[model samples]
Target: MRFVWRWRRNPLRRRSDVVEAWAGVAAVVLMLVLGTAAGWAVGSFAHGALREAVRQQQQHRHLVSAEVVRSVTGTPAEPDHESTTGREGYGRFLARWQDPDGVEHTGLVALHQAPGPADRFPLWTDDEGRIAGRPMDRATAVVHAVLAGAAAAAGAAGLVEGVRRVVVWRLVHRRYAQWDREWQQAGHTWGRADAGS
Candidate 1:
């Protein structure tokens, strides 16, 4: 692994040793710079795109008051019941809301509390008065971007390390085979006046 001695005056240093040393340094430097740059670029682009989407949703989506038409109960079966907000949720209920343009829409709504007939609840609507989920927020967008960037960096690092290992291992094998060939050539001719060093 020590390459400094290879460049110095040495009887045992082979050309392959110098090549391996330089290649190792180059590979490490390149991986660091390229991987980090790629990760940052991907992260920044993703963040900008996601933030724009959130902005559009916030601008167009509106909260309208709706009246529950049917009583809905029972917790829905969820594969992942874990809630990040640490709050329990109520079931869905049928509700109707009138849009700003005077068009009315009805859909299933999830509420924190049980809803009876004529109970008022807040409903999210898109620009065309269609029922929609809650609008995306800036915080969620940033979190997603950060996670994506980290994943990119990790993936790049893993791939680079795997390739480096394979190359180094092959180089070691080749060096050993070269040593064996040299030994076989000089095995029976050592210390002879005709077999010169």
Candidate 2:
């Protein structure tokens, strides 16, 4: 009468039904356990890797004061999209800054606002004094790690669900085929009144 009948001793319960029920239970349990384990493991690994990268960036990247050499007049057709500063009133200039090694380097830098004569702004550079983006912050690294962990958990759960669906699909087909065979056998003696006697 109820779906739970599959788990109890009943004449109407077929072997395939019992197997399907157990399989469904197993799938739910596995999805939860595997998803959680995968999420935690991937999250831990990603956090450790990102933290190490942050440390390396902090060690190798230096922020130094750069003087604006000359302003590039007129907005170029292509602006520096990667500029951390907002693009409105954006100013492009040839800037010079000294590296940690006391070597001077000049490059085109984008600023949020036009600079006055002898104006200076902070710029990030590598050891060789080439312009570089700001180093990754700890908060950003943590957020990325959390996102990766969530993705991994979802992927694990999806994989488990897919496998369960495939197994259940096969079980259902087998059950249907078994029923078809029984029906065909019964059809052979359908008109015989003494068939069951």
The per-prediction tally of clashing pairs is 0, 0
List TM-score per model, in order.
0.71, 0.82
Evaluate all candidate structures by whole-model CA lDDT and list the values in order. Answer: 0.78, 0.86
Report clash pairs, candidate 2: none
As for candidate 1, its clashing pairs are: none
lDDT of 2: 0.86
Residue-wise lDDT of candidate 1 within 125-185, one digit each (tens)? 8888777668899999999998888788777877777777787788899999998998989
Instruction: Give candidate 1's error at residue 115 in angstroms.
Output: 2.3
In candidate 1 the C-alpha lDDT for residue 149 amounts to 82
lDDT of 1 at 139: 96
Which run of 10 residues does model 1 get worst, by summed lDDT? Answer: 77-86
Candidate 1: stretches off by over 4 Å: 1-14, 72-90, 183-197
- Give RMSD to native, each candidate: 4.8, 3.3
For candidate 2, lDDT tens digit of each residue in 1-197?
Answer: 55588899988889988888888888889989999999999999999999999999899999999999998766453444235434567777878899998988887788887897579999988888887789999999999999999999999999999998998899999989999999999999998999982
